[model samples]
Target: MHRRASPGSQDHFDLFPYIAILMSLLGALLTATLGMASLSLGPGVAETWDMAARDGTASKAPVLVEWDGSALTVHEGAQRRRVPWLDDQAAAAGGMRPRSAAMQRLLAEFGQRSATGYVLFAVRPSGFATLPRLTDDFRAAHIDIGYEPVGQERGVQLLSAGEHP
Candidate 1:
């Protein structure tokens, strides 16, 4: 009978060992090409540079509010007060409900009669899903809330820092 080869006679290869090295090489090439392309393109526009309405919104600052998942806070000129933005904490929590007394009072302070009314919400990325609830709650009270719908970075920075919107 012919002698059979042992179980360890053949070597096994693991593709995973080379994956990182291959990826690193490809990524370096791609990154270098992108860098050269951007440099050739010159400085077009900065990511944070906004040249839209400068002083048109200076008449009055938009009403700003910050939501932190479980709590809501209103921003005045320089003061920030927590308000009860939810009618119930558990049942239908994110559902649109009547404003609480504290929230009503807070709104009453910034309440205005502009042709276009709005309430700015400085919300975290995590709170983005609940934004509809916040807007619905405000609109339910007859206050038109206008949001940028994009560039949430600036809003997050200003509103989260308690700055006047």
Candidate 2:
């Protein structure tokens, strides 16, 4: 049937209300998503981002920091060596030093071996708690450190040069 819309009469049902309702629902959903995103960006998050941004130097080798349930270790290239911590019972009670003697030795070794000035540090789950101080220590030695978190299954992830931190 060909029914024309008259001057003061309707030929079909008005869909404006339906469109308005859909728009309202979409607006509500958008509002919720934005609110959640804002909540996630806490004060600490911004500070951490700023800190990461400060280390803007391009990195080289990917070094993973690992903890084998007993000791802290480092995996660089194919070498997985134990980083012997000092006898500081209180710092970690678990006997893990944030800045270890073996680490200093490793730094010397890197100085002799690698030609690159930066190294990205990937931390194992067990070693994450000890990472902050260790990263700071590496920075103190003029080595750039970028964060890379290895999964539970992968003990150490050695990212290649083409890959990232």
Question: Candidate 2, clashing residue pairs?
Answer: none
Candidate 1: the clashing residue pairs are none
| lDDT (C-alpha) at residue 35 in model 2 | 93
- Candidate 2: which stretches are off by over 4 Å? 1-59, 67-71, 88-98, 111-117, 159-165
Which lDDT tens digits does candidate 1 get at residues 1-165?
Answer: 999889899798989969999999999999999999899756542222121245545443356566755456666646777887656743476666665667677556545543444566666565678778777766766776665333333333233222243
Quality of model 2 by C-alpha lDDT = 0.59
lDDT (Cα, tens digit) per residue for candidate 2, span 134-165 = 66666666665577666545544555444454
After superposition on all CA atoms, what RMSD does each candidate show versus the true structure? 11.9, 11.1
